[model samples]
Target chain A: MNNHDRFVTDTAADIAAIARTEGWLVPPAPIGRIALRPWQQAVFWGLRIYIGIMLVIMGLGFFHVAGG
Target chain B: MSAETDILAPAEADRITYTEELEARLHDRLRIQRLRSAPRGLANRLALGLALIGPGLLVMLGDNDAGGVITYAQTGATYGFSLFIPLMIPLGFIAYLVQEMTIRLGAVTRRGHAEMIWKRYGAFWGAFSLIDLVVANILTLMTEFIGIRVASAIFHIPYLVTIPLAFAFIVGILVFLKYYTWERISLFVAAFNLVFVPLALFSHPDWGAIGRTFTGSGWALPGGLFSAGFLILVSANIGTTIAPWQLFFQQSCVVDKGLLPRDIAASRRDLMLGVIGMVAVAISIIVISGQYLHDLPNAASLGDHSVLAGIGSRLGHGAMVIFALGLLEAGMIASIVITASTAWAIGEALDVPRSVNISPRRSLYFYAPAILGTAIAAGVLMLPHVPVGFLNLTVQVIATVFMPAAMLFLLMLLNDRELLGEHVNSPIRNVLSVGVMVMLIVCNGLYGIATVFPHAL
Candidate 1:
């Protein structure tokens, strides 16, 4: 429950019912953790390579700006 | 638990709801949800839209920061009523289209940008992204202080006095205010960004000349678009228009403001308003300088203090003061929003409780980064002869350089069928998003070559 504020009271369940009747869930579901998929690491590495190149070029360009 | 056939008994109704710890964010969000079921009328609809509108407006306006103001000013001063004016309109639409994805991601997923990146992509990219965001934020914050410092100087206030004073106000509001209160105060300050609209009119910009830019003549750059300065300025323009922090900030803001999927359309309208404000302010700043400083011998290199002084000399001290005040407001609002973005990204990535409602007493960790980060940025501002104009433009360029990574992560998240369900990016959006990514890379690369070669362009 570290990520959740756990509380229980059947009284608000009546109030929650009102929201449910209106096509809403009073307390919505959380977007919890997910298992990393197969292609994710590949994609992340590709991102790293692209960013690494951009960073190097940008660093040089910025250095030129600073120096000149 | 089924409701009784009639109203609840007095004894049962007396029981307090959510006794363990009803988070302020959740409580506030639920209150807005109640407003959604209000009777259909213009007033009620307007109220609901206003309540759900913070994240997009904050992100778009927050981007028209110290760097943005200076970059737009420099564009007008250097190129004068060129393609840049018409360019800003399309850029605004592109910004809207790009940022609109974050609304669905945040609303449907109910997770912050950093949290999604961390959980979905794993901790390495998350930590890297967090670091990049914090460092960029600090550098960007220093540029903000420069804006403040320059504005203060216009009024004869020293940096020693103004920088820390602004810092105190920033930290004070952050440590004290809750989400709704803090957001409203920020919005009020953001309204001053429109000061540029009047400044544009005050500059007496030629309507014919401005309109003719849409014709072929305005498309031509004086130094040619390939020139080093022109390329860098163009890249800076792109950088300012669609920044990385914007992606992180808006989504996290949407999550923090507790926007549900039901509120996405309203949030899109909010984003459109933001796009309009952002483009208008940018064009106004460009026109203000285009009217006065464009023909100056050193217009391209005027920087903050000199540009205002240049306008003051022509348009009187009133215009100078107005421009400086706009910069001051822009810097201040961007500083506040950026600080929150940094803290929120850190908190979410690290799994600390992240909300504006987290009192400093309960979790000093939440507010510590903001205070320390601003302190460091302000400390940098205090140093002698910090080439802040170049620094500001450099911050924008840096934003352009690493923008691909930010966009990549965002695109991936938005396309996540598991999380966004029916809200995933459409085929057309995919094409546009990829095009934008490529455009960012090309802009950065072209600037790089131009920077090194100097005369190559």
Candidate 2:
């Protein structure tokens, strides 16, 4: 099989093993704290807006509108 | 099953081992929620996204160092932003294309650029590339120090005080911080470059002129002394947008940060954002310069300091002060990154010890290049009539000429089935890369003609 197929197969096995090993599972509180922190939210918003501005500028760039 | 199914099968087992190490490395941040009875959710995806963000962003911002800022500044001051505006679009795409390959190569091979070069390309070719990088890096590092010196001079801070202090601050950060902390703190510093955006508003330029620049009609202006000077600025602009050290730095950082295939998409996204950020800040420099300094009767004679001060003055004292602060921040940020790149390349290539995780005492080999690079650059900046302008111009030309050599190695390694396999670049990527390489060659040729025979036009 190809590398992609091999990757998928190997990853499936690893996930299966991880599921079987209850010790590896993270609890929900830690998950929420890590994922929902205010600063973390800020990074998300910041990146999103940054990308949006770029897309608009890129559109303008295509039309030869952006200043050098 | 074939005998290859046996656990001892060399290739398959090696692949398995590689994947395992990569997964364990990523495990801390991968954060897969149990979907079986627990639930499949978006939170898992978000965690993965945050984890992959560093390498690309670092590479993009890293490319827009002090050298790049000055190049963009010069371009705007000399040319008034007409033809170069559209060029940024293609250049940003080239930055993304070349960098994305490094991401794949590092993730798949688990080797730094230096190590791969040493192994596959043989010692002669490897040493050649290494020497070129080290020399170019030393020269470029000097430019960063010069930037800090010039920026400090704006506020009447002497170079003697600023240069050594800047060195100490950069060494302190790299020596004390681990890979993750170093990356995060550098991003914070890089973020300050965006201060130029609001500063750009003070230029009071005609938006129509800016818009007209992109339409190609504005680009058809007469080619004379003005165009020739602008061409030099364009060469500088290209140099700032694409640099050789960037590939080495990002690939090493990816391996150092333990990015895996799963992290690749987020890394690309982060890189795309960084490119946009870099280009926006770059254009802001040009706009600020073009609006204010371009009109100065003695703008050329005003020298580098006058040009910088001219931009600062237009933005009001508060803005200029902030711009100076941004200069210090951006210069320091680049110093840390470039110094680290030098250290890492040396360590990884020579098989000496490396990584910021090791104590300074333990990783002296790694820290040595960084410390030495900073000292030499600082030392050079303190000297009289140090050929700052000529060297700055030469740095851009040299970088453009040498860019293809580095990009070639990256492309070949990425395309090698033994290394990247399915991760190899798509055909479209190959075409785009070739196009970028050709464009660089032609631009560098024209740039050489303009510089060597300035009066030819």
Candidate 3:
């Protein structure tokens, strides 16, 4: 085999070994899901709310700039 | 649905991954092996280190984008060698600490940040981060083009001419060159970011006053600390320093460069150098603007073209030409790196053949989005009276709105013990990281409020 093909085959083996141990590069399913704790959930939701509000405020301001 | 087919699926999947990784990273892997076998010496180690210095350096230099240069210029002109110059030192360390996590994650996990988020967090949060990244990238790319468009004015080039040429050059390098060559070309381009250094020296800044900023006198705010203008410049500086595109770009770059766990220390050293380069250039621009442009009419609100014009009149036409080149280089280099960040992230999330190495003929779809995104940004900039300046404002707003969440994701991934094993963030690291994160989020909030409600501040 050519060096490049050999490299691919060798890498395939190495990846398979790693997949068994670490995880796949493009995992079909997540290895595990992070179930957020209460505070963490709150923080995430707060950030979401913050993004929503800022987008609205900025959106209005944007129109003002465009219109102005 | 047969059992045999199911059984073969994983092996096939592994092979596909192997093909992609090898295609993208074969050169890097070979270099690592050669470095391993080569005789150990100071000169050899330096060679090896240079070989290993792609992701961190690119990301840090990449952070000092067109928008970043303008922000630093604004800081210097408005605040004038005050707190902001000294502020850059800690900001540099913060950038280092934040980016260092990505190196560890990339080296150990061998997966890009986008892939990691998609896999561990599932598609809901995955899509959220991806949309944010892509949207932010498109909008930010607009500002880069605008910078290039305007900065080209210094050379008597019209925006009509500069924008198309800039667009073609950015697209050509990204689409035509593979990862290794692409990075080298990019670094060569990025080195021009330091042109600000000479421009600063030419300005003949007061050495004692500049030194005094670090010696506790720098805290004297020329503009009141609570002024809306001061707050805006500070937020811009902070936003430009630590950014979302940075996390995706550096991590994917490391994975693409095929860095193993053994390369982590060298990568950290690489990241440190990037931070230093990023900050020093930032300060240089600040010094240049502080010396020449600060006293110009309404200096704080001056655009890049205006800053260059100011420099020309004050420092001479020759220095202005150099400064303009620096500005154009900032936009050009940023356009390249940020576009790659988008392509890499989208390629990872979609599970397509994504890499700098992926031949356009084989997997053209992988390259289309970034190129298309760039085209859209450039197209928008070219349209008649398109309110392109407002779009730059939108870029800052989107970036501010997105940064806190980006930091949160980085910290969570670093603390993922199952993935990182013993390399997980230590307790002290966690505390410091959380502190910085909280501070960033607060600044982001203030950035939002100050931007949206000019009267409120």
Winning model by lDDT: 1
Predict model 1's lDDT versus the native: 0.79
lDDT of 2 by residue, A1-68 (tens): 12243234344344334423422233211101112246634643443353344334323322331122
Location of the lowest summed lDDT over 10 successive residues in candidate 3 chain B: B1-10
Off by over 4 Å in 3: A1-30, A57-68, B1-21, B384-394, B447-457
Q: Which of candidates 2 and 3 is the stronger one according to lDDT?
A: 3
- Among residues 3 or more apart in sequence or in different chains, the pairs in candidate 1 whose N, CA or C atoms overlap within 3 Å are none
For every model in order, the TM-score on chain A comes to 0.49, 0.43, 0.54
By lDDT, the candidates rank as: 1, 3, 2
DockQ of 2: 0.02
lDDT of 2 by residue, B1-457 (tens): 2211342434433343222323433232323322222334687556555555777777777677766776676666666756776778777887888888887877767668877777776665567567767877887888788778888887888888998898988888888766656777888887887887887876577777887788864565445533445554565577787778888888888777766575577678988998898888877877777666666653322335666667666656776676676677667877888888888888887777567555676667878876887788888888976655444555665666567667766776777676676998888898888788777766655644554555665
lDDT of 1 at B416: 78
What TM-score goes with each of the models? 0.90, 0.78, 0.87
Give the Cα lDDT of each candidate. Answer: 0.79, 0.66, 0.78
